[model samples]
Target: MVVKKNPGKTFEDNLQESIKQSNEKIFFSRIKDTYIPPDLRQKVRVTKNDYDCMMFARSHLFTLELKSTKEDRFSFDESIIKQHQIDKLLEATTYENVISGFIMNFREPTNKVFFVPIKEFIDYQYIAKNQIKDHKYKAKINKSSIPIAICEEIGIEIKGFKKKVNWHYHISDFITEAINTYRSKV
Candidate 1:
């Protein structure tokens, strides 16, 4: 099924809606930043969570960081996904029945979404770094970005469908697959 594009709705919104439609037992909550006035910015410091949303499904907890990029690759630099976010996701994996990772939306030529586990992401980063360093001139590297091709290989690709009003992704299936994959590796 084709995803019905709504210019106003973000990928996160769609995903959340999809989760809502999937099941009642699955609990999903988006971690929204507290609204602070511009004048109070100097007085208060805000620390954000590593993931955008948290899900509790079938006795398992999941923390997912959502990212949408028009480009073909996602860069690991501080400008995109921060160092603290990566650290937090990695730390979350240490706990039992906790699944943490990223839900990336590639929204350019192809509107494909992928759920990449934190461990796989870290492993890919190391490989990408070495590839760039060893073959600086020969490697087809794009500013240390993880290309969509690699994401497809290492990540669980999530399918999308058009519902009544917006595009909804297969969040339930993603959760099941993520859990199974993580369990298999462990």
Candidate 2:
């Protein structure tokens, strides 16, 4: 009998390679969703994690969860964060060293990205409780709910959408704005 090792690498390895190469494409290539066999899916444990990308600038950390929708809208559900992830995020937010949040990458009308802090997400969890319908959870956040100070216009055509749409989302201040709003609370 012979034993073989799986060739796939961990997320941290892929992240380091992406940083060393100064290319997000590299990181995404490694972590991007791939087709899985039914047997494989059952054998592996999948996380209901919200974040798609996370990195550190100096001592401060930023965990960015990526999202996209066919329609020109952004929606979030309570299930996006698992119990453990929620616990970790809650603990991280309490300290001055971390900035965890989500980025909605819109691929319709035009390419756009919207940033929402984890705190805002937690708050919405409570606010959205009033939006229950037929025992199902629902919430819709509009442009007004999004702050212009923390968005960006990435002028590139994002592939793999239901329709051909330009990406034009922009967020001006990333770290500074986060520091001002989130850091103060810590």
Candidate 3:
């Protein structure tokens, strides 16, 4: 019998390779440290979408959506923010037991990270009720099961001369950082 390839695993490998190539830090130690039983690693699945790096491990999982733009005005797409995770769960037939996952978007040239809970932040529509500065907003996670559009590049902005002073994101330093961050969190 021919074996089927796992897209999630492929995407995760690509992400790791990209990070490694850049000499930056991307953590995979969480795979080993999972409280889930050893049998579950087999349960874990990885994949990709139009522009996402997906991973699954039991009731919770994550996706690192990759993106790049010409200038500074970049943002995350409001729709299908969790589609990768949702689809993964659907394929595994265990999504009913899972709560939610996270969506981390990386806008290129600006190694800044915007992390949001798939079910909480991504799915919600916030309506601003106030005028000018006092506008109040209410938001909710979209329960409609729509396609996950995780990243968006709205536009860009002009940086000041001081931008030269910002510390560059060295990949090796970032890799160490991702690992250390995960270590402390666990």
Candidate 4:
């Protein structure tokens, strides 16, 4: 008798699970009804003409790329609009579908990194500028290159989500903030 393995989900599934375990909190932004966190969905990806994104959540799909070095930043020589990515996304786009873009830097923790959606990158250049300001390398790109202090560049965005992080948590800080956010939402 001959037998075969399930082959299961291949590799992407493992990658997504790793990301969700480490970074699901970032994707849990309050949308409407009950919380729909990153862990809630299995992301599907469609790649065409050298562009791809993971389909996840309601009206939301995410594409992720990992950059290892600072040089990788601002280094993509591609169209302002990800036409190829969009063409695939177009098929999946729906009343509840929104494309969440991400140029992930795996070298750093996802929470510390900033990912600007493809649309935002096209619609508002300023968003990329603000997001990338996380890197305080001593290089002059332009007037917007406000010389950053060493302490300022230490890092600000949360290094990871609450539920999955393995390190310490400033419980008081989170409690205060959560109360404020939940109150505001109410």
What's the candidate order when arranged by decreasing lDDT? 1, 2, 3, 4
* Residue runs of model 2 more than 4 Å from their true location after superposition: 1-35, 46-50, 77-87, 131-172
Q: Tens-digit lDDT track for model 1 on 35-114?
A: 78999989998887677888999888888888888898898888788888889888988888988888888887758999
Structural similarity to truth (TM-score) of each candidate: 0.83, 0.53, 0.30, 0.35
| Residue 104 of model 3, lDDT score | 34
Deviating ranges (above 4 Å) for candidate 4: 1-15, 20-50, 58-60, 63-68, 79-83, 86-95, 106-112, 124-158, 161-186
* lDDT for each residue of candidate 2 in 1-186, tens digit (9 for 90 to 100): 886532122223432443544422212221344556897998877654434556565466766555555445443334433445545566666766777666555444544445566666565555444543332223342322322222332111212212232111112234446656666654
lDDT of 3 by residue, 27-63 (tens): 3322321245677767876443433444333222334
> Whose lDDT is greatest here?
1
Model 3 / residue 182 / CA error / Å: 14
Please report, as a residue range, the 10-residue window in candidate 1 with the lowest summed lDDT: 132-141
- Candidate 3 global Cα RMSD: 13.1
- List model 4 lDDT by residue over 1-186, tens digit each: 887522222122333444455433434221212334676545643333433334343223443332222222333334323445444433332323343343333222222333334433332334334555553344432322211121123212213333442322232232233333322321
Q: In order, how many clashes per candidate?
A: 0, 13, 20, 3
For model 2, the local distance difference test gives: 0.46
Q: Is 2 or 3 the stronger prediction by lDDT?
A: 2
lDDT of 1 at 73: 88
| lDDT of each candidate versus the true structure | 0.80, 0.46, 0.33, 0.33
Tell how far residue 15 is off in model 1, in angstroms. Answer: 0.6
Q: Residue 144 deviation, candidate 3, in Å?
A: 19
Q: Ten consecutive residues with minimal summed lDDT in candidate 4?
A: 146-155
